[model samples]
Target: MAVLSLKKSNLPSVWLFSFQVIFLALFVGLKFQTGYDWPIYEAHYAAIQRGESFYLDFEFGYEWIVQVASRVGLAFEQFSAVVSVLEVAFIAIAVRHFFPRYCLVVMAVMYSVPDFYLIPTFSLLRQGLAVSIFLIGVCKVFSGKKISGLVYFTIACSLHYSVIGGVFLLGLVYIFPLSRMTFSLIFAAAVVLYVASFDIIRGVVEVLIVYVDPKYMIYLDRDVFNASFAYRAAFAVVSLVIFTCIYSAWMRRESSDGDHFDRGFGLLSYRLALLGVLIPLIIFGFPTLSTRYQYFFAIFVIGCSLGALQYVNYASRIMVVAVIAVTAYLPFYRFLSSPLSIVYIPYQSQLFYDQTNSTGHDRTNDLLNQLDVLWSK
Candidate 1:
C-alpha cells in the first residue's frame, strides 16, 4: 500500500530528486575516462598548446570555450570538473521544474548509466556544449516555449550539426499536436518500411551519405553499419513497435506540470526513434556521429526509464536496483588504487593524432599532466 501510494504521487518530490542527481555526478566523475571522444579532446587541447591561432585552426565556438578557460588561468582538469558540475546542475534544475519529486531519481539514474557518462565527455567542447544546450532546449520545449526551443536548437546546430537529431523533434512539436492513434499509425508505418523495403530508406541514406556535409558523418562508415545491418534492422523494428505502444500511452497519461502533454509526446517519439536507430548502429559497431548521437539518445533513455519506474512492479524494481548497485561499484573498484583513472584513456592502443608526430597530442598531455601534478602538489 505504501509503495503504491508513493508510485501514485505525480508531482516531483525534491528530496528524491536531489539525492539522485548528486549520486549521478559522483558516479560519472569517477568513471570520467570512459568516453571515446576523450582522445579527440586531447588532440584539440594539443592544438591550443601549440601557438596555433584557435579560431583560425578550429571552429570559433569551441575555440572560444578553450580560449576563455585558458585566459581565466583554469587548468584542463579544473575546466573538465566545472563542465561536469554545470551539466549536472543544468539538467537537475530542468528536471526539478518538471518533475520535482522524482528529479533526483532521474539525475541519479542519468549519471549511474554508462551511456550518460560517455556522451558529454566526448569531445568536451562543441559536441558536449551542444548536448548540454540540447537538454536545456528540451526543458524549454516541454514548457511549451516553441520559439525558445528553436533558438536553443539553432545554437546547438551551430556548434554541431549532428545535434540536429533534436531538430526533427522540435519541428514535429511545432507542427503536430499529440494524438495516440496517429502516433501509433506512424510508428507502424516506420516498422513496415523498415522491414519490407529498407532499400528505399537505404537509398535516401545513400544520398545523404554522398551529398550531406562531411562533419555530420564525423565517424560514420557504411561498411561498419552494414556488417550488423540485419540484426540491427530487426531490433529497430521490434523496439519501434514496443516503444511506440508504451510511450504513446505514457505521454497521454503523464500529468507533470511545466511539461506540455503534446510536447512530451513528441519528445518521447523522438527518443523512440533514436532507440530504433541505435539498435542497428550499435550492432554494426558504428556510433553514428561519434558520441553526439548516443549521448543525446541516452538522455531520453534515462528520462524515460525514471518516468517508467514510477509504475514499475516489485520484481522489475528490484532488478533495476540491482543494476544500479553493480554499476555504482564498478568505478570504486576500478579506481580505488588508481586515482589516476580519472584521466585514464579508454583506448590506449590506437593513439589519436599520434603522440610522437603530433605536437597537439604532446601539449594536450602536458596540460593534462600539469593538472594532475598541480592537484597532487
Candidate 2:
C-alpha cells in the first residue's frame, strides 16, 4: 500500500501518540483485581510471597519475574503494573519503528481489535509480554538484523511457549516465500479441512497427549470448545482474516516498488496475514489454540490493513476505518453480553477500588447468576 505522507514535524500527532502510550500504560498497569485472569495471577503471586515453588505450568521467565518481585517486596499489584508498562512500551516501540508517520493510526487499529490489545494486555499476561517482545523482533528481522531478531525471539519464547508457533511461522515465511495464489489455495484447503477434520484433529491431539505436557490438555476440553462464546469468537476472527486478506492484496498491487523497505516489509506482512487466515481455519476445533496463536500473525494483519489505507482515497479510507471500528466493537459487545462480563465491565483501579468489598462480591454473584442462566438455556 502507498505510504501516508505526513509531515516530519507533525507535533500534534506525536503528542497525541505520546498521550495514548502513557494513558494505556497507566490504565492497564493500575487496573486492580479485574480482568479474566487476575485472580489466577494473584494466587500465583501469593504463592511466591509464601516462598512456595513456582508453578510448573508457567514459563521460567514469568516465574523469574514473580520471584524477583516477591523478593524485592513488591506487591502483586505493583509487579503487574511494571509488567503492564513493559508490555505497552514494547508495543509502542514497534509501532513507532515500523509506522512512524502513521503511528497513531496504526495504534488505533491495533487497540480497536480486542484480541490484539485488550484481551492480551488485560488478561493474557505472559503471552502478551512475549508477543510484544516478538513484535520488536519482527521489526528487527524486517530491517535485516537476523541475529538480533533470533535473540529477541529466544527471549520471547522463554516467556511463553506459545510464541514458538509464531517464531516457526515467521521463520517459515522468511526462508520460503510463497506467492499470494499459494496462500489463497492453502486458506481454502484449510477451511475445507476444518469443516471435515474435527475427529481427525481430536485423534491427533489424543495421540500427542502422551508426549505433550498434561497441562495443555485444558486446551482440548469439551466445555471450552462447546461454549457459545467460542463460536462467536471464531466467527469474528475468520471475518477479520478475510478482511485482512482482501486489503493486503490491494496493498501489494497499489503500492510502488521504489521503496525497497516498504515493498519487502509489505510483502512479508501480506504473507503473514494470509497465514493468520489459515490458522483459525486449520484449528477451528481447537478454539484456544486458534485464538492464542492467531494474534501473533494478527499484528502483521493490522499492519497490512493500515498499509492498505494509503492506497485508498479519503472516502474509502473512512469507510475502511468504519469497518475496522465495527469489527472491534462487535467482540466487545459479545463479551459484555456473556456471563463473564462482570470480570471486566466496570474498570477498577487499585488506587481507588477495594476488590475485597461487597461491590466485588456482588459482581461475583452476578457472574454466577449469569453463568447459571447460560448453562440452563
Candidate 3:
C-alpha cells in the first residue's frame, strides 16, 4: 500500500499524504464541537438534493463524481463525508506526485485557508466535488498533461460555474510569459480591481434587483465576507513583489534550457496562481460580492499556493526538514487562536473554538441542527 511505502523511499509524498489524512479526518470528526461553517455546507446539501444548480456562468464537470459518491452511500452526509475525505486525499496524492518538493507547502496552503475546512464541514456536495476535480487538473498540469488538465478543469466547471475562473486562469498560462512587465500589469490591475470591487458589486446588485425582489438582497449578506480588509490587499501587493523577485532570481540561476513545456504551459499555471490572489481581493473588498468572490479565491489559492511552493528553497534535501516544519507550523500558529480558529475558518479549528462564547455556541448549534436535518432528509 502507498501508506506502507513511507519506510522505503523517504519521499515527501508520505508526509503530504499523512498531513491530509490527519487534517481532513480531524475536520470531519470535529464538526460539531468546532463550530465551523457547517451550516453553509448543510444548506448546500439541500440545494443539491433539490437540484438547484450552482451558478450558471460556468459548468462543473464533476457532477458525476458528486452523484456517484452520494448515491453510493445510504445517507447524504455519509456520501459528502466520503467525497470530502477523498478530495483532501486526492490533492495530497497530486502534490506528492508532481510537486514533490512542495508537497508540504500545498498542505499548508490548503489547511491555512479557513474555508477549506468550512466547505466540507456541512457537506457542500457539488462544490466539494468541483474542488476535487480542480485538484485533478492541477495534477495534470504539473505532470505535463495539458489535455488531461483541460478535461479535468472542464469537469470541475460543470460541477460549479465558479470554477470557470480556474479554467480562465489556466488558459492564461498559455498566453504571455511571466515577466516584470506582466507582473506590473497584474499588480496594477489588482489595485484597480480592489478599489473597484464596490462599484462592480453595485452594478451586479442593480442587475439582480431588476429581476428579483429587493428583499432577496439578504441572501447576499453573510459573515464570511465581513473579514475583507486592507491587510488582504497589502498581502496581495507583497505576494506580487515576492513572486516577481523569486521568478527573476530563479530565471537568472537556471543553467539549462529546462523543459520548454514546463516554462511554456507552466505560464498558465503561474497566471492561475496570480489570478487566485487578485480575484479574491475584488470579491472580498466589497461586502456585497464577498461570498461569491470567496468561492473563486478558494479555488485560486490552491493553485497559487502550489505554484508558490516551487520557487522556495526546498530544492535542496537539507532544507526539507525546515520546509515541513515551517509549512506545518505556519497554519497552526496563524490560525489556532481567537478570530483565527479553524472552527470559523475551516482547517484551523483548534484556535477557532478556543475562544468560543455563547454566540459561537449558538451558531455552531444552529449549523449542526441544519446539517442533521439535511442529512436526515
Candidate 4:
C-alpha cells in the first residue's frame, strides 16, 4: 500500500513505455474480420447498414453504437477501432489513478493472463468495454465518489447485462467490506463444493430463471458443461495460489507512510481478488459464466497482485514476479498453439487490407464454419 512518488526515475523505462504504446496501437487498430466474435458483430453491423432490425442478442448500448456508426457511414473496422480506443482509454485512466507507478507491470501482468487481455479485448468486445468502465467505477468508488461510481456502474450494465453480476458483487463488497480472512474461508468452501461436483448452483439458477429472461436459460444446457470445466477450475485455483503468495508478502511487510485510504484500497483489492478466484468454483456447472465472470474479477486480481509487489522484499518480489511471468506465459503460449489460435494468430490489421490474400480473415471463416458444424452436431 506504499505510495511511490511520481518521479521520473520511478517511472517505467522509455523502451518499456514505447513498447506498450506500440502494442496498444496495434491492439486498437486490429482488423475487424480477425477476432473470434468479430464475424457476429460484423454481421450485425452489416444488418444495421442494410436497414435491418437491430440485433437484440446484444445489449442496448452496443446496439446504439452500431446504429450510430452505421448512420455515420463508418466501416465496421472503424467502429471497432473506436470501441478499442475507448476501452483502452478507460483502462489506462483506472490504472493510472490507482497504480500510477506500476502501469507497465500491470499491463505486463494483464497481457500475460490471456483471459484478462486477449479473450476480453479481442473476443468479448461488449463485455470488454463494460469491464473497462466498471474498473473506472471501482476506482471512483474507492476514491469516495460513490455517486459517480454508481453512474459508471449503471452505464456499464447498460452496455452488457452480464456486467450486472459484477455490479452486484461490487455492491456487496462495498457494503460489507469483507476482510481477507473471510474471503479465504469463502474461497476454501467454494473449492470444496467444486471438488465434490455439487450442483447446488443449479437451484440458484432455476430460481433465477423465474425472475430473469428465458433466453438466458441456454447457458444452463447440459452441453454447456464439458471438459473445459476442469481446465478453467484448475486455472482459477492456480491464480488463487499466486494471489495468496503476493498478499501474504504484502501483509508481512512493515507499514509505510501510506494513509488509511491507501491501505484500505489494497485490502479491498485483495478481497476482490479472492472473490474473483471463488467465482468460477461458486458457479461450477455454468462453464460460460465461470469463463466470462472470472475475467471481470481478473482486473482486480492483476491490480492487487502487482500493487502488492511494492511491499514485498526484493527476493520475494522477484520470486512472485517470476512465478507470475511463468504462469502467465504458459497459458498465452498454449492459447497461441491451440486449435482456437486460428481466430487470433497471424494478426491482421485494417491498415493492410487485402481482398485476395486475407489469411486472418480466411482462418476466422474456417473456424466459424467448424463451430457451425459442431453446433449442428
TM per model?
0.63, 0.82, 0.61, 0.83
RMSD (Å) of each candidate, 1 decimal:
9.3, 4.3, 8.2, 4.1
Clashes of each: 8, 0, 19, 0
Q: Score residue 114 of candidate 1 by CA lDDT.
A: 40
How well is each residue in 91-150 modelled by candidate 2, as lDDT tens digits?
A: 888878866756776666677666677678877889889999998899898888989998
Candidate 2's error at 362, in angstroms?
A: 7.2
What order do candidates take by TM-score, descending?
4, 2, 1, 3
The CA lDDT of each predicted structure is 0.52, 0.72, 0.51, 0.71
RMSD of 2: 4.3
Displacement of the residue 31 alpha carbon in candidate 4, Å: 2.9
Candidate 1 on 89-150: residue-level lDDT in tens?
Answer: 66677656555544545455555444455445433446666777776886787777868977
In TM-score terms, candidate 4 sits at 0.83
lDDT by residue (1-377, candidate 4, tens digit) is: 11222223466654665467457846755655677888788888899899987455788788887889899999888888888878877876676676666676676666556667777888788998999899889888888898999999989988898888988887787668876667777777777777667768887888889688987776665424443555556656575666575466446532453455445555676677767767767876886677688877775666666655666565676666677667656546556666756887777777776566677667877887876765666
Which candidate number would show the highest TM-score if scored against the true structure? Answer: 4
lDDT leaderboard ranking: 2, 4, 1, 3
